[model samples]
Target: MAASGKKNNILKVLLIIVLIIGLVAAWLGYQAFMSPSIATSEDYFYVHTDEPYESVIKRIEDEGIVKNPTYFKYVAKSMDLQNGIKPGRYKLSKDLSNRRFIGNLRGGYQEAVPFRFQNLRLKENFAGALGKSFEADSTTFLNILNNETIAEKYGFNKDNFFSMFIPNTYEIYWNTKPEEIIDRFASEYKKFWNADRKAKAAALDMTPEQVSVLASIVKGEALHVDEMPEIAGLYINRLKRGMLLQADPTVIFANNDFTIRRVLNRHLTIDNPYNTYRYKGLPPGPIMMPSIASIDAVLNYNHHDYIYMCAKDDFSGYHNFAKTVAEHQINARKFQQALDARNIKK
Candidate 1:
């Protein structure tokens, strides 16, 4: 009876020990899927190209997503995610489990960054915008864009390179390199300059680049959309007659002072390739990033006998086009009077 009692006690102890072990196993299993791990408030995690899983773990800790880096690394290794790490942007969940986190990292589940650009003044400005949201820095992107050899590969110069970036929202990875973005732009440029546009440009004796240049000028001059085609027509007429464009916007560009509300005689004297007052043809490149609407307006310019354009004195964002110098002088004097009334002399 004593030996029987002793064996029964031993069996009870073994049962308790086994229950503890089973409970521990269940808790660990729950930790794998049910427990919350990520603590970040941000929406996503950005994994760069060629980044290792260890580096990702470090970022997880650095970003305050995971409280325990060591345990997260252990979980990642156990799930065979160390070598299966993907390079991309990933969505971050607040209540993300270890298993789901590992799965997301292992699978190339990247969030497409909403990359957008518009109304850019210079290549450096574009680079600054990109650097704010992307991994590539301003100087790095500018160097690649301004490099003669790299620009040659894309068949662009620093001057015309701004024309390639169509102002639109693009879904691209944050880790996108300069070369990849440029290639995408090149594709977009090809799509924009379709066979029909090419045919029209040929009819006008202009290349797509030349059209973009004129479009930039038209865009600079006209604030109202309805005036774009009219301004485009006047410039086309001037170009056909081999007359000087004498665009105030081109003078502003030559002066490099965007703040100059009015182009004076002094501004026109600055001799640069962009000075349409001195140069008889289109500038070497676009003065600003022209919109698609402006570009298309140039492609289908109105047939007009006008060779000059001046802003209206009423400040209606419209222009008065003229076939003779005397008419332009009349329009200019009216606008000058308006400018004088507003104390705008520059």
Candidate 2:
């Protein structure tokens, strides 16, 4: 009976040891799987294309995404995250755990980047903006834009291809390829020029691209949205009369000097197709990306007889429209006097 009691006491000690081990194991499991892992300053974490797992781990540490990476690394290895690291922009909340973070990476769950672009003047500007927002560099985007074959595939030439990208906030993956981005723009361009818009373009005896070209000039000329329709009307009148557009914006574009606040006579004499003063009709392509409002203004231009325009002397960013060259000259003289008064001699 004493021997039996000793065995019972030994069993109790062993059971206590087992219970302690179980508790420690549970605590470790909870730490490894459920503890808050991410403590990032940035709301999103970017894993670049072809970036190695080691680089990503280092970035997480360097970027202060976590206080301790050891447990995260352990979870990642258990989940096989290193072998299957998906390139993407991932949203990291403060509540994300090691297991949850590794699970997202392993499952290829990534957030889409909301990319917004506007007021871009040149293809270089567009490429630079895209490069900053995506994994593809500026050179990659520029090369695709300059490729004549790709341009033709999208039903545009190199000159007019700039008009294809409509300015708006778009959702795209950070790892999206340049070709894929171009394809998305093509899809958006088609969607923007619907039946109603196409009919409006047709009524004006212009293609959608041509309308965008005129819209770009109007966008450059008018800062006020209300003035766009009237400015578009003035240019349309000049087009109807077979008169040279003589738009100062075109001369500025041809010179490639955005700093030119005042267009000089020499600027008009620039031997370039983009110089509307030298060439009749619209320029070969859009000088800049036209806003949607600017494009719509062209399609819904005011019906008027005004064929000329000069910036108002008040410097209020409005233009004075005229039916005759004499009236336009008067407006121009007043604006010139105002510019002289301000010492704007450029």
Candidate 3:
């Protein structure tokens, strides 16, 4: 009876040992199959400009950069990277563990390049510069601004193509679509337009577009912010009296070249609708992109009876105002004398 009891005890101990070994083997197998491998593989991965999150996962899977697309999607969701993935060209490899890769993507590993719009004149050049910075299609982007249908929808005429846009520095994700970027800028512009500006535009008997046109001229003419209000008033007075604006900027625009070192009789005769000297009322559109200061100047213009202005030779950025041609000619001669003395011709 003692021997049989001992045999039963040994059999139980052996069974328990086998069961423990089996459990451990199963656990090891599960871990090996579920975990990402750290073995390096030759694969290229790309994240297109403005590509959605789901598309990014598919690209990762398709390029063999990740072992499983569904698993990556799950990880990305848990990390809250669904809508936060930046657009750019990314090079990835399978050597990275799943956790490390997810962390990298969520951390925003791509670089941001800034596109600045300062002292720029042409709309096409602006589009091209932005496109090049973002690796987008420059031609396609510029074409949108040039398109008659699109321009009309945006409340733009041929003359106002460049004027409608405000200049500022923008940080755009690489590969963003050109149209998407334009829409983004339009949305940003709304912050500059408040109720007060809208009411002021209404008081001037002008649309926001027309106000922008005047503001652009103000931007090009004024040498300082302090000069804008009075310059704006001078133009408004001329408009009210049915007198020619006779702005030198208009003549420069009509000439289709900005290097107007001197304005002459020939420049006045080169003639397009933009020449306020030849045609009455405001030019067809603005001559340059206006700053907020210039826009505000036109909106809340000072109520003055002055109709003419000439730049002061003192370089104080202030203009001499006159109400008659004779007074204006005297101021003009003063400016001319100063210019001639400085070897500047007009």
Candidate 4:
């Protein structure tokens, strides 16, 4: 009878030990699968296209994004994440749990990348910047930008293609194709030429394209926002009188050299249509990417009789405007002297 009692007691103790083990296992499973697995380290993780599973897991471990890579792997495998990997830019947060984090990636949930276009001096530079910002490479982007056939679809040429891109920020997926980017910007350009802006352009007796052309020159000439209107007014005066634009910026564009600090007589004689001195109207396209401010300044140009402008000799990033050639020559001479004193021969 005592032997039977001893056996019963031993069995009861064994059952209790089994129950404790099961509870511990359950807790660990919950922690691994349901609790947060990401650390408070980074706010983003980009799972590049065509990346293999092991590389991604290793990268997650290397970046300390996961609290425990082993546990993460276990949870991922259990959740069928091995067959569900999707490439994209994923948002990371410490509050993200293992299940939520893995599920978000598996479902292809991604953050939109902010792409900004501004102050790009050339299309090649713009393409390079876009390549770094998006999935499209610069060669592909440049090909699309320069393709005469494709450019015609957007009403653009190799030189005026940049006008389609309004300088602003766009939130788009990182893997957006080059064609889609072009289409989106074309849509934006079309949308920007609304009835009101179109009427303003018509009031100036100009096409939207012509406004962009003049705005680019105004932007090139003016360093301060306040000077843009006056500079634009001076150009408008010249245009009204059928005078040669004679814009130095256009000459620089014609020379294909932006480093010319002083426009010499030789530079003015460039035979290209873009050379405003040689041409009687606005350049065939914009000389540079005009900003919205510059465009608005042209649309709402200040009414004035000034037909000429020269950079201020005071070096205050302002310009001196005059209605007569004599006054403009004086201002030009002063600015030229300043440039010569500083040895800016180019």
Each prediction's total of clashing residue pairs, residues at least 3 apart in sequence or on different chains, is 0, 0, 0, 0
Give lDDT tens digits, candidate 3, residues 1-346: 9999999999999999999998887765433334663333653334666677777877676766666556666666766777667656443554565565666566656544566775555677777777667666778878887787776766676667666566777776666677777776776666566788888999989878788888888878898888898889999888888889888888898898788866888899975998988999988777777777888999988888888888887867788999888999999899888889989774
TM-score quality measure for candidate 3: 0.70
Residues 1-346 of candidate 2 have per-residue lDDT tens digits of 9999999999999999999999999988788889887877688888888898899998887788876777777777888887988888888998899888888887779988789998889999999999998989999999998888999998999999999999999999989988999999999999999999999999999999999999999999998999999999989999999999998888999999999998888788889999998899999999999989999999999999999889999999999988988998999999999999999998
TM-score, every prediction: 0.89, 0.96, 0.70, 0.91
RMSD of each: 2.5, 1.4, 7.8, 2.3
Off-target runs (Cα >4 Å) in candidate 2 are 1-3
**Which candidate has the highest TM-score of all?**
2
Q: What is the C-alpha lDDT of each candidate?
A: 0.84, 0.91, 0.75, 0.87
Model 3 RMSD, rounded to 1 decimal:
7.8
Order of candidates by TM-score, top first? Answer: 2, 4, 1, 3
Tens-place lDDT digits, model 4, residues 102-159: 9988999889888898876678888898898887689999888878888788777776
Q: Could you tell which candidate, 1 or 3, scores higher by TM-score?
A: 1
lDDT accuracy of residue 43 in candidate 1: 84
Per-residue CA lDDT of candidate 1, range 193-263, in tens?
89999999999998888888899988888898777988899889888888998888988988989999988
Stronger candidate by TM-score (1 vs 2): 2
Worst window of 10 by summed lDDT in candidate 1: 65-74
Span of ten consecutive residues with least summed lDDT in model 4: 154-163
